[model samples]
Target: MNRVIKDTGSKYPIIQAPMGWIARSQLASAVCEAGGMGIIETSSGEIDNCKKEIQIMSELTDKPFGVNLPLLFLKDDSMVKFCVEAGVRFVTTSAGDPTKYIKVLKDAGITVYHAVPSLEGSIKAANAGVDGLVVEGTEGGGFKSPVEVGLLVLIQSIKQNLDLPIIAAGGIVDGAGMAAVFAAGAEGIQMGTRFVSSA
Candidate 1:
């Protein structure tokens, strides 16, 4: 099969959403083992704690995985540097503009994926030179856009307007949902609720 996302040598396009406080090492490791990219949420912003989590994840499996960094908590470039030093090859940035850290992560040869809730945000992130875009729709839990666009609509909108690969998120709960996203022109799908149940 032709997987949509190609980062750090992993072939599958799917990414397990890095739900803070819910996405534990075991869960993340499980996804990676299943041929999809797993991500640990280090939203805590403490470099030391993040490092420990990275180490724990590393021990679980040697497969490539990523870390989610909330841009709001990162300061003074510590989190960026920590990811680089920790040898993480992929990172998903959210909660703030991720453009500022693009060059830093790119220089380290890390692939940076930014999250967006609207077409405008997707365009901005693409203009900011993100390697990929995770388009989160209204059905997604946690903080969401006031516009409340659904995944299907957002995917089509992003694909029409942006050249960057799009990772669709929100209300995806099964293999059928995954297939539907790929049919809708999403390069990949990010699943949060489904993974929680899997764990």
Candidate 2:
């Protein structure tokens, strides 16, 4: 089985990008039902609301799902505790260093994948013992590095330097784009804009 599928426990190697506000129970549960990994987003900084959504996701779908922790936006460790207490099995950390919460999450048996826009970040995440990488290229929407490295080059560069599973994010919207990322060495794909319109 594909590493992403195995790690995520989803039927498809597709992960929905945890876009703020948009990535909640309704869309996430739908993604889970459709066999893709659904992720609850904490980027909105609405901790209480996000927790409610996580609880709602449990009632909405039996399929495995995940959550995203954008570290930079966090005000405290409450979000981490929320995920661990909620029994979340998978999480993607972004907007900060992966090392900050790797041990705590891993200690709770959560699989961790860090979002990165550069090879340096990828290396740092991999070395931090994250289970995988969400390799966000410059083309990806929302917040990203100022440097403009396209998906192809970014994917190839990370794959060449690290053996961690790469979930390519940025500019992928269809089967053709997914195929293109896989061909470049990514094991899975994360789509934000496409999924926003999808649900």
Which is the leading candidate under lDDT?
Answer: 2
Q: Would you list the C-alpha lDDT of every candidate in the order shown?
A: 0.82, 0.94
TM-score each candidate: 0.92, 0.99
Q: Which stretches of candidate 2 lie over 4 Å from their true place?
A: none
Tell me the lDDT of model 2 at 47.
95
Quote the lDDT for 24 in model 1: 62
For each of the candidates, give the backbone clash count. Answer: 0, 0
Which digits, one per residue and each the tens of the lDDT, describe model 1 over residues 49-98?
A: 66777789888988899998888767778777888887888999887887
Query: On residues 1-199, what C-alpha lDDT tens digit does candidate 2 reach at each position?
Result: 7899899999999999999999999999999999999999999999999999999998999999999999999999999999999999999999999889999999999999999999998999999999999999888999889878888999999888989999999999999999999999999999999998883
The CA root-mean-square deviation of candidate 2, after full C-alpha superposition on the true structure, stands at: 0.7
Model 2 alpha-carbon miss at residue 116, Å: 0.3
TM-score of predicted model 1? 0.92
Model 2 global lDDT (CA atoms, 0 to 1): 0.94
lDDT of 2 at 37: 98
